[model samples]
Structures are given as structure tokens and as C-alpha cells.
Target: MASFEVIGGRKLSGEITPQGAKNEALQVICAVLLTEEPVTITNIPDIVDVQKLIQLLSEMGVTVTREDEETYTFEARNINLEYLESKQFVNLGRAIRGSVMIMGPMLARFGMCKLPKPGGDKIGRRRMDTHFIGLEKLGAKFKYDSSDEFFHINANGRLKGTYMLLDEASVTGTANIVMGAVMAEGLTTIYNAACEPYVQQLCRMLNRMGAKISGIGSNLLTIEGVEKLGGTTHKLLPDMIEIGSFIGMAAMTGSEITIKNCQIQELGLIPDTFRQLGIKMEFRGDDIYIPTQENYTIETYIDGSILTIADQIWPGFTPDLLSIALVVATQAKGTVLIHQKMFESRLFFVDKLIDMGAQIILCDPHRATVIGHNKQVSLRGIRMTSPDIRAGVALLIAALSADGKSVIDNVEQIDRGYQKIDQRLNALGAQITRI
Candidate 1:
């Protein structure tokens, strides 16, 4: 129900630090359920989705102590396993997609867990098959109830590890399976696992907690089951999606903004992908400095073909930032194609951009060709609605660069990912007001 009233055409200049990774926070927070010892986590992003997950864990008797605004210590020594069957738990679980991850640790330690259908963005159909299939490989049985839309999962005894070849490289699925395998009877090998920086961080943290996990940053993961795991402190990397969004915002609004503590090395191919879009950025230590620019041109292929930017697996451009790249291309000097291969409905938000006077051709559900105005045609601000998290931020960036004022409703979607985005951007001279 919240909205953002953004006044466009204002140049922003200041330094903003990206928040901790949202994806990583969800995974590591759920990993706390694997051990009864206290797990201290710092640099946690205070976003809506993460807060919901923390609340869920606390309600399950996980003894969550807030050390500070960005730090917490979780001890799951007295978990109330019976809470899983309550309507309150189901309501809370279905509200956020991250709640599904707790099932892995629950079944691994407590022998049983139940989950309602998880809810998240309506971008596309996100299946739980990968998670179930991987868990089943380690001696787990699952039953689905169509009447109540609940999933019942149980293991007769301690999980027995085995090898699994995932049908897809799903990040959350891989994290769940790895958590289930960490305390199994034998070794577990996972192929085609998602090797994003988030997953790598989880694996490293697991190893720190006395779990034998190798292949930290590759598609193949090897896990040697241990009888138990202990607590360890973990810190999250800066959110690369937010860093990419900031770079796009700077290019579109002719702003000179420096993003601090970006963990640039873990942001694989993100900087280079934005560079291909002609957004100039400098890497100063761990910070990214994007200078003011009136115009930036899109780069074409060597043989004069129109450049196509598509989302692929890790080490490739992330699908989460494709919307920002598409928006940035609207004001660039040349044409570029944005291929959103991961989600079919993600590119549908271009209709809002079109209403703002950007020249974009929605080729299909999966592709869009943006013909840049090169700042020749100033976009006129208008009222809009945020469809999802990434697209919401993309629209907000467009509104910041438009000629007049714009109101974006349903900003809760944006808050699910970005941490106080309006306040952070407003600190950098952006006129974004929460209404």
C-alpha cells in the first residue's frame, strides 16, 4: 500500500553503501536451524523479506537476539517443532519464499516438517521440484496435500547422503540440499549446483561451522557428512543487484555517485556488463565511482550486429539486474536488445516505460529492443505501479530521470529487496519521498 513520490530531473551526487546481500541473508539465516549452537551473523540487510524470515525463526523458538541494527545471534536449542502445523505458522510461511528453506534443516534434525505453498514475486512459476528432488536423494520422502496446499516431508532416520544431478542450477534449492546433507551419514555430491557468490558464501560458512564442504565456487559441490555442526560468525557480501541498480541510476540521471564497500571481486561480470551498456564506472579499491554523464552509447557487436544482453547462469549477467539495464538503454545513444531468459513476465514492465515516452519494442515475453533517445527526448513523468522488486526499482530510476513528478504505488515490492531505498537515494540528492 506504500508509494514513492519521486520528483525527476534532479542530479544526484554523494556516496551510498550497498546493503548486505538479501539472497545470502535468507540462506544463512535458515542455515542456523542445522545446529543448536549460537550463530552470529553481521551485516544483515534490514529488508522486509529478511525481517519476515527472522520473525519466522524467532516464532519457532530459535532464540533470536538482536545485537544491533545489522547484527544478530540465533540459537536454535529449543525449537518448537509442533509449531509447524499451526495456521499461524502456515500464514507466516506462505508470506515469504525464504520460509521454504527451513524445511531442509527441520527434516535433517527433527525428522519431519511441513510447509504451505511459498509466496513471492509473481514474475513466473518458481517450482520447488529442485529442492525436493535433491532432498529425496538424501533419504527424504515428500507428500503434497492438494486440499490445503501443504507439503509434508519426513525422514525415517538420519539422512543418508548420495549423489544428485540437479535439473537446474537453483540457488535456494542448492542451499537447502547442502544444509540437509551437512549432517547425513555419508558423503553427498551435487552436480549442476548453483555457484553464485551467495551459494559460495553459504558453503564457506558451513565449512567454518565444522561441515566438510568442498568446491566452494564451482557447479560441482562435495559434502562429507558430519555428526554435528557448531556455530560460526558470518558476514554477507554487498548486494551486487543494488550496485548494478545504482550504476544504472547514475547513468540515467546524469549523477555522480560513489557506491562504497561493493565487494567488487565477487560481483562477477556485473561491472563489465554495465560497461558494455556505456555506463562509465571506476573501481576505487572496493568502491565503484560513476561520474556524471549527459549521454552514454550502447556498444554494438564487432560485426555490426545489434548487441543482445541475455541473462545466463552465474559468472554471466544476473537476471535480477536485466530490468535496470533495459531502463538504462532507453536513454543511451544506440539500440540494444534485453533478453530476460529467466522470467517471462519480467519484461512486461516496459509498457510503463513506453508510457513515459521511451522508444521500446517488446518483441516477446522474453525479449525487448530498446531504441535509445540519447537524451534527445526527455521522458515525461506519470503515475505507475511496481510489479515486482527489480522492476519496481527500475521504474523508480526512470522516474528520477523523467521531466516531471511521478508516483509509484505498491512500493512494498521494492522494500522486499532494497533496504530503505528512498532514504538512501534521497541522501544522494534524489527527491524521493515515501507517501
Candidate 2:
């Protein structure tokens, strides 16, 4: 029920370290359940989702020892599979979509797993059909009880891998199958798998734990089933989404800020895509330094035409960040069309942006056209509530550049990913307070 009160138009300037990637951390923590020995994860962000996952694991009898604020050592050696059927475990399953991942590990080790319907951003229909289909290919039978609303998966004896061509490149679906395939017999060939950074990180971590996986960053993955996995320490990668958020914030507020320890190589096309908005940034070794600029303009095509920014799958722009990019475009000096192709409900938040005096036309459920300030108008502040994770951050960026006070409610949605967001923005002189 907490909210953020921000006195807007403050120049955010200073050094701000990005938290560990939330998506990657979620997958990595779930990967720990695949091993019986102690697995230590460093640079774990203190966020709501991570905390919820930790509580779920603890209720299942996994010993999670926090060595420090940013590190946790977890051992699932003594986890009771019976807890997977508990009402408390089913209740916590609604806390995050990643809770579905525990299904694979529990079934792999204990031959049975039960999970309630997972919960996450209400961006669109994130079907679990891919997950169930992939697991079915690996010899797991699923039964759904509509009255109780739980999925019961049972695998008698050892799981035998078969050829699985996922209907779509579902991120969590690919992760769940990958964990399940690690313990199956024979080879598991996964075609059209999700190759996002978080998926690749899970494959890498499983490899470190003795799972044989090939094609680490591609749509086709081959996993030779292994009998057992051991423990290993793995550092979570720098959050590229957080990096994109920082870039959007710096550009909108016209602040000079340095983001340290960014995994620049893994950023793929994110930096170049942001540069298209005329936001100047420099790479200083592992750090990304954003400098102050006046009158930033949107880049036009070669024939002097307006351009459009869109999102796609891996090796392309991420759909998760299209909301942030759209907010940044409002402060630029030209017009750009943003196409959010993946989620149908994502662009609906533009009405809030339009109320703050932004010139935006919601062309459809998945697209919007933004006409920048052209250095003539600035958005005035208004009271609003955050709707989702990426959209919430987009509103925060808008609030920072607006003229007066803006109060944003439902801040717990923001805390699910970004760690200590107010403190980090405060370091950059943003007048943001949590109440």
C-alpha cells in the first residue's frame, strides 16, 4: 500500500549502481532447487519476488542462509516434497510466475509436483500451455483440478526425454523444460526454445552443475540427460533491463549519471536502440556513462522522415522495455511510433501519459505514436498509480521530468524488480520519497 511522492523537475546526477537482474535472479534461484548440495548465489537483489521465492523454498524445507545482504547460500538437500502440496506453498505460488519453475525440479527429484496457477504482470495472456506441453513430452502426466485450481504433475520412474517443439518461444516454459530435461533419460531436443539472456543464464548455470547442454544462446537446444547435479557458485549478470531504465531516466531528466558494473557485451542492441533517440552515452570499460544534453532529438530516416521504435524477440529489442523507451521519446525533440508487438494490453497506460500533457495517440492495443516536446512543452505532474513493472518505471521517469508534484501508488509493483529504487534515485538527487 506504499506510494511514491516526487517533487518533479529535479536533475538526477551522480553514480548509481544497478541491482542484479531480477529475471535472471529468479531463474538462477530456481535452478538451485535442481541440486542437492549447497549453492551460493552472489549479488542477489533484495526485492519482493526474490523474497517471496525464498519464503517458498523455506516452507518446502530448503535451508536458505543469508551470508550477507546481497548473497544467499541455499541447499535443497532436505526439502520435503510433501510441502509442495501445502496450502501455504500454493498461496505463495501466486506471488510470482517463476514459481512454476519449482515444478520441474520437484518432479525431477521427487517424482511428483503440485503448483497453483502462477501470477505475474497482467500484460496479456501468458499461457502455461507451452510449459505443460514441454513437460508432457518428457513423460510427465498433468492433471488439473478446476475446483481447487492446482496443476498436479506426476512422473513414475525416470523421465525419458523426447523431441519437443514448443508452440512458441515461451521464456519460462523453456526454463521449466530445461530443468526437467536435465534429469531425464536419453537426449532432449528442444526446438524453438526461448533464447533470452535469462534462459541462457539458466542453461549456463545448469551446465556448471553437470547438465549437458548445447546451443546456449539459440532457439534450438540439446540437453543430454544427466543422473545428478552438484552445487556451484554463480554470479548473477548485470540487469540489462535496469540499464535500459537508467538510460531512459538520464535522458528524460537530462542528467549526467554513471551506471557501474554493467555487462555491456550482453546488452546486445539495447544501447544502439537508445542512441537512436539522440541520447548520448559512453562505455567506460564495464560502466555506461550518460552525459547531460540539451535539446535531444529523435533521429530521422535518411530521407528526413520520422522513425519508429519497436520490440522483437531475442537478438532484437526486448518487448519488456518498449514502455520505458516510449516515455523517453516524450522528452526528445521529434515524433516516433512505438510498436509493442508482444503484449496486447501494454500500450494502454499511454492515457495516463496523455493526461500529463504528452502528445500521444494510442493507435491500437499494441502501438502508440509519440510527438516529442520539440523543446516547447514540458509535462506537468499528476497523481497516478503504477499498473505493471515496466510501465510503472515508465511513469516514474515521466514524474521525474514533469513540472510539479506527482504521487504514484501501488509502488510494491515497482519493488518486485528494482532494488532500493528510491535510494538509488535519491543518490542522483531525485526528490522521491516512499510513504
Q: Name the candidate that leads on TM-score.
A: 1
TM per candidate: 0.99, 0.98
For residues 1-435, could you state the per-residue lDDT of candidate 1 as single tens digits?
999999999999999999999999999999999999999999999999999999999999999999999999999999998898888898999999999999778878887889999999999878889999999989999999999999999999999989999999999999999999999889999999999999999999999999999988999999999998999999999999999999999999999999999999999999999999999999999999999999898999999999999999998899999999999999999999999988889999999999999999999999999999999998999999999999999999999999999999999999999999999998999999899
Can you give the lDDT of residue 29 in candidate 1? 98
Tell me, by lDDT, which candidate is best.
1
Q: Please report, as a residue range, the 10-residue window in candidate 1 with the lowest summed lDDT.
A: 103-112
For model 2, what is the error of residue 54's alpha carbon versus the real structure, in angstroms, after optimal superposition?
1.0
Model 2 worst lDDT window (10 residues): 103-112
Off by over 4 Å in 2: 303-305
In the range 195-314, model 2's lDDT, one tens digit per residue, is 998899889989999999999999999999999999999888888999999999999888899999998999988999999998899999999999988768889999998888888778
Looking at model 2, residue 113 earns an lDDT score of: 87
